[model samples]
Target: MNPSHRLSTFNITTLALGLAFLYLPIVILVIYSFNASRLVTVWGGWSLRWYFEFFNDQAMLDAAWMSLRVAVTSASLATLLGTLAALALSRGADFTGRTLFSGMLYAPLVMPEVITGLSLLLLFVALGAGRGFWTVTIAHTTLTMCFVAVVVQSRLTSLDPTLEEAAMDLGCNPARAFAAVTLPLILPSIAAGWMLAFTLSLDDLVIASFTTGPGSATLPIRIYSEVRLGVKPEINAICTLVIALIAAVIIVASLAAKLSDARGESGAPL
Candidate 1:
């Protein structure tokens, strides 16, 4: 083969290997979720026994529901607060201590989950606050908002500030100008941040473990505890369902974003 062809072949092989490395384990787990036998390793032909069992497990169902609620609440709060932080950092005039403020805003992005969780746990203890649903949600929001801020800040930096100014020049108030012009333009980023925050909060295990109180176990905690005893088909089944749900959400969101972009581009003047 020519040198260019050889390089193309190498890239293809690398891509294939990388994808297999990431997804092969997940594929095995998904396949075994339908296993007829109790053993996870042994393929006992395909059946939906485990799916039925998973749905019938009231504790697992409750934990899943709780996780959903926490994820939604935290993601929304994070998105809202993160957007505000991004606006301050990206749009507002430079002020004293701006660097310190920026560092603090992004600190949680690099902070270890264990450390973050421990700090929050200590704070809750010092405040004599009960640890439960709201505590878990707050912890998730704290860790996730930094990520949302990063995403929104990137979008804000790329936006044309003159668009908002032009709206204001057209007699719109500052808030109305943002709502009519800047908000629509940055909406895709806001949505992307929300999805990312939701995914992070949902997949979080370490922070949830530290902050969760009695009767507020999320799905990851429940799954981890069960896996400690032994891996069960039910665990596989539930995980597969969770994976499917997340995948569906991502696909729908991606399509909506693409459609929005297409419409915006089409309407722009030549």
Candidate 2:
């Protein structure tokens, strides 16, 4: 065989193996969600029994609702604050503390989650803020907003400043020019950041464990508690749903980005 051909074949085999390593467990869990038997591994034919059981679990339902609220509210708040931070980093003039501000903006990405969670937990205690839904939301917003800032900053850095400048020259103020010309172009990144924040909030367990209070358990917390007892088919069913939600968000974000590119190519506002 040709050396180049052999290398290509090896690369393909490596990629396939890597993908299987990551996804095979998820596939097995998804398939086992439909298992009728109480035993997780032994197949006793497929059915929707687990799905029905999952729906009937009131604690899980409440936890799911709480998780949704936290994810949506935190993601929205994070997206807004992150976009502003990104603008400051990418567009604002250099000034005193600019370096420090940029460092703070990206620090969360590398910070240990335990340290972040513990510090926030202490801050809440200092503020006399009771631990609960709002506390978890605050913690989540703090963590995920940094991720959003990183995403939006990349888009802002790559964008041409001339477009916004031209808008201002054509009678728009600075803010108006940004709103009219700059925002639309960078919106795909903002949308993606929001989705990422949402996923982070939904999937988080450690930070939520530190910040969450009684009667305000999130889905991950509830799932963890259940899994400690042993693997239940209901847990598998819930995991499948969570995976589907994350996958859907990614697909929508990708499509939105493609659409924005198409609009840009056609000389339309994007």
Candidate 3:
């Protein structure tokens, strides 16, 4: 084969291998979620019994609900704060401590989850605050907001400042110009960030484990506890549902992004 063809073949093989390495275990788990046997390792037959049991388990259902609530609230809060931070970093005039501020904003992105969780736990303990639903939500917000900030800041860096300037020159105030022009363009990034934060919050285990209090166990925590005893088909069923939910969120985010792009192309109003 020619060099170009050889390179293309190598790339295809690498991609296939990488995808298989990442998803093969997940595929196996999903397939086994329908197993009729109670033994996780033994394949008796295919059935939906585990899924039925998963739904009827009140503790799992409650944990799942708690996780959803925390994820949604934390993601929304993080998106708002992160967007503001992005705007300040990208659009605001230089001020004293701007460099320090930027570093602090992005610090959590590189910080270990264990360290972050421990710090939060200590702070809560020092303040004599109870660790529960809101504490978990706050912890998730702290971890995820940095991710949102990174996403929004990248979009802001590539944005056309001239559009907002032109809007301002045409008698719109800065906030009005941003509302009418800049916000529309950066919305897709904000939405992507929100979805990312939501996923991270939902999938988090270590941080939640450290910060979560009694009676506030998340799905992951509950699953972990269950798995410690033994992996079961029901755990697989719950995991499959979690995977499906994340996949659905990703699909919705993609469609929303495409729609935003189409609107921009069609010159739709903000």
Models ranked on lDDT: 1, 3, 2
Candidate 2: pairs in clash = 184-270
Q: Could you give candidate 2's per-residue lDDT for residues 1-270 as a string of tens digits?
A: 887666687798999999999999999999999999999989989999999998999999999999999999999999999999998888775777889998887888999999989999999999999999899999999999999999999999999989988998899998899889888988888998999999999999989999988899999999999999998989999999999988988997898788778878999556
Stretches of model 2 off by over 4 angstroms after superposition: 1-7, 267-270
User: What's the distance in Å from true for residue 37, model 3?
Assistant: 1.1
lDDT of 2: 0.92
Stretches off by above 4 angstroms in model 1 are 1-7, 265-270
> Between 1 and 2, whose lDDT is larger?
1
Clashing pairs in 1: none
* Ten contiguous residues minimizing lDDT sum, candidate 2: 1-10
Candidate 1 residues 190-270, lDDT tens each? 999999999999999999999999999999999999999999999999999999989998999999989998999998999
lDDT of residue 166 for candidate 3: 99
For model 3, the superposed segments whose C-alpha errors exceed 4 Å read 1-8, 268-270
